[model samples]
Target: MSFSLTTDARETFIFAAKNVFRDYETTPPAPEPITGNTWDNVTGNEVKEAALALIRDGKDPAKDKSIQELLLRWQLSQSGIFPVLAAENENQTLINEFNAAVKGLEALTPAAEEDAQILANAASRLTIPNLGDSYSGSPRDAMLHAGARVADARLSKYAEAAGTLLYLRGIQVQGEHMTPNWFALAPLTFKDAHRHSLRSAGTASPWTLAHARINIEPAANIEEIQERINAYTTGKRAIERQVEAALPQWQNLPRDAYQDAITRAVNGETMRDARGGIVTWAN
Candidate 1:
């Protein structure tokens, strides 16, 4: 079966595309003021307020539309631990500090505005792919799936290590169980994500491509997704080695987590359905 991403899902795909291309944009000498709707035009202080409100009084999607939308964009943007994780070499102390800072209410707000702007800039530079096209088990579709796996692997490794995954989970309110979507450019409405590869065959920088290759080596060949995943023993083993490697020494600062699910999914023990939901295999 094939599926085309919904509007929200397409935005999420674009988010991943931006994630890989955020560094290449040109901006004004002075940061331009953010412009948009009432929900969209909120300031840094307001974002912090919304964050607190989200933690203190979880916004209902219906009643608290404004703050909820703001919070959604912030979290969905490159805020919190994302910038750190998305850094070239993931850091340890930064991970430790981010795990610590999120507990307090003040430190994260200033960065929130900047990160949202970064996403804005990326969106301008990004040539959004044909997300409207249907995705089946084609090579392009596989590239998209493998890209999401790379995303999950990258996230699960560090986020799980720093204890931030479940820590963030504990803060969920209104019974909304957050998934990889909440963190990465992973799509929410659709059960999966789109990342750098889907944006363009050759647009991702060598660094980003190298990062993906380190975890899933065969993934370097976007066409490899067409083969049975189980046959990619080298890719699976590459992921294992990456999983077991020692943390890189502390970098100056940046960010901070997911793994088994991806390995199993990659090895064909589990898989995502057409809509991006998880589908387990009993055999």
Candidate 2:
């Protein structure tokens, strides 16, 4: 059977494309705001108050503890962690700190670097004919898949040493029980197979080609999604390697606790999903 991506799934795919071509934009940048709020103002005291409250009341260790301890249980659901915190909010300072904290955990190391290299070397020896680059359909699809596998292999190697596959350019995490997750460029509405790719693959086209350039709005969307996934994955893998290289240095940081941080940061879920142990994210 032919593989197809759903609207939700393809959203991530499109995001990856955008990241791939992030340096090349078709749109002109709007003039910078002469007077606009920053990440602090955007996030505001109100949200921080709420985030802190969750840490103090909902979490076991209150604000009196380390930032890592404070964030431990609250990382998931935003009920405590507050995913509503925007990067562009008026508080880029705090946002950057939080982002770094999350990235820091996924940046832990493991002992499988040599094994990964062996796998990558084996993959490099395998090749399939690429007749698709000359065409716009099956051949194109084949080429895309081949390129993705090569990239995935490289990422896998990084994860082998560090722990998590870096799906986003700046994001990283370990692999134990981690999902091969991807995010979309736009907020997605989950619908059934009636939506194009999920349904009639042979009869329907989610997008079209015109003037030798894909002439579908959905194409742009998919491209951006793909770009994000690739960027994040790359960064995530890099962090993973760093985690391995510096594992012994950060020994003061708890093992189970740190791993929990990785799960909360990467999957945005509970620590239970992170290697069957509970961990925390410092608020």
Candidate 3:
């Protein structure tokens, strides 16, 4: 398979190693496959194919020509044109595959330049599964659905990893808040209500409010976030299902994307004390 590294290779590698050696002391635990789980029987090819099909049907061809072209590229992935991904090295493989997928997608659909750009843009946030430990720890991350602020930070990280452009959606104390550079990344902010959905009956339990609106961080963009939301719905759904099944105790939990994003956003920003509450950053 094509060889390359995604932006988060260094962090992923260290994380994966720790999972294998120390059983993931610092991060969320991977879900365990149930006895006779389909995931275990499924080969890497099957998983790749699943990803391809999800990408293929995820976007609307009429609205997103670039995504249409990307759909074709995903079809090609099914043929094994892509490089051999080192499955054991989730970070390396994800990085390599993401890079290769974008390059191949671009080459195949040069005519749809905008579409290609969009695909590449969204693909940037996609990340491989992290190293996880199921043996010693609880079946899930105890800190998964901790709180709103935590969820927001983790949501940002999830967006970063999944290639979804995100905004902090917080009140701007001043015209200029010290936020991440949107120029280098596609960051934005929205009204709290819009960014944070509240649960309502007869609808998704963790439904977010629509009133909150996003503020364009000077440097970040959300066009790709929209595209990502469209393109990988199935895969995302599958992940959601798997996570929910694994951690039924936390069902109806708020936006997992938010939680994951926040966790990664301030990866080393804080420490937790005995009650699992935040402590001052060691630094």
What's the C-alpha lDDT at position 112 in model 3?
25
For candidate 1, report its TM-score.
0.19
> How does model 1 fare in lDDT?
0.33
Scored by Cα lDDT, where does model 2 land? 0.32
Model 2, residue 217: C-alpha shift (Å): 14
Please give the range of 10 consecutive residues that has the lowest summed lDDT in model 2: 203-212
Q: Please, what are the lDDT tens digits per residue for candidate 3 over residues 1-283?
A: 2334445653453343332223112322232322321111224455456556656888434455554555566576656544433344444444444444333322322222222233233223322122122223333332222222232332233223222112222211122232222211222232121124211111211102111222222122234444323333333344334434434443444676445433422232443433455544211
TM per candidate? 0.19, 0.18, 0.18
Off by over 4 Å in 1: 1-100, 128-181, 184-187, 191-283
Q: After superposing candidate 3, which stretches have Cα over 4 Å from the reference?
A: 1-146, 160-283
Error of 2 at 260 (Å): 5.8
**Model 1 lDDT-worst window of ten:** 184-193
- How far off is residue 9 in model 2, in Å? 13
